[model samples]
Target: LSKQTKDPRKKVRMLALAHFFEGKSRYQIAEYLKVSRTSVNKWVKDYLDYGLEGLEELPRSGRPCKLDDAQLKQLKAYVLDSIDRTEGGRLTLEDIQQYISESFHIEYELSAVHRLLKRQNFSWISSRSI
Candidate 1:
């Protein structure tokens, strides 16, 4: 299940692996599973290569990670715990994100801040009414 898995394709491969391990031949698995034999073989190979998680497709390509979680949490704490909190109370998303940009020594774009906060279940409200 995607809820329990970080990799969806791995879930599929896990199912296939289960069936094959249960003594089903690849052709039977393929026919019953409505997948090409090659697909079944590939998933099985990937399963063997790196276990189930490896069956999930990786990001096609990327530069690489430049930061780590401790750094990110430190930045979030700075933004959430240190920024303006008064009768006005609490940094707005933009303010917090801007603070993150300045304080983290990283240049995060506005959209990136929105995405990150959204991932964190944080949201924005109108400052004047906020």
Candidate 2:
């Protein structure tokens, strides 16, 4: 059953169940599993309350991205096309930042802009040759 489950947490739960059935104390089980006593208690409670389904991880909530997928695709296409038509075919970080502000109406920090570009597989190359 543990092998079938892909989540490591579920595997841990299975181990906890095994130890629980063996009549081990919650503290002993926690020590064996290298987890906190509180975690073991919660897992046992969850198993009793919801069975196997309760052991699954809950979905997490996080901050939403300022730019949507369509907007990102459009931005990539626009920047690449603009670079093709420019003199040296290179864009500075500030230039990209300004373009994002004007086109998407979203302001990002210089570091954030660099991270976004890197995530999109865009890199900086100096146009001037040494």
| Top-lDDT candidate index | 2
For 1-130, candidate 2 gives per-residue lDDT tens digits of 5578988888998899889989999999999999999999998899999998888888779756678999889889977886777456467788888988999899988888888888789886657422
Task: Give per-residue CA lDDT, model 1, range 24-104, as digits (tens).
Answer: 998988888788999999888877888756677776785443346876677667756644555566566577667766776
- Give the residue spans of candidate 1 off by over 4 A: 1-9, 21-41, 48-61, 65-70, 79-92, 115-130
Q: After best superposition, candidate 1 residue 69: deviation in angstroms? A: 5.2
In model 2, pairs of residues that clash are none
Give residue 67's lDDT in candidate 2 (0 to 100).
Answer: 89
lDDT of each: 0.71, 0.85
Candidate 2, number of clashes? 0
Candidate 1 collision pairs: none
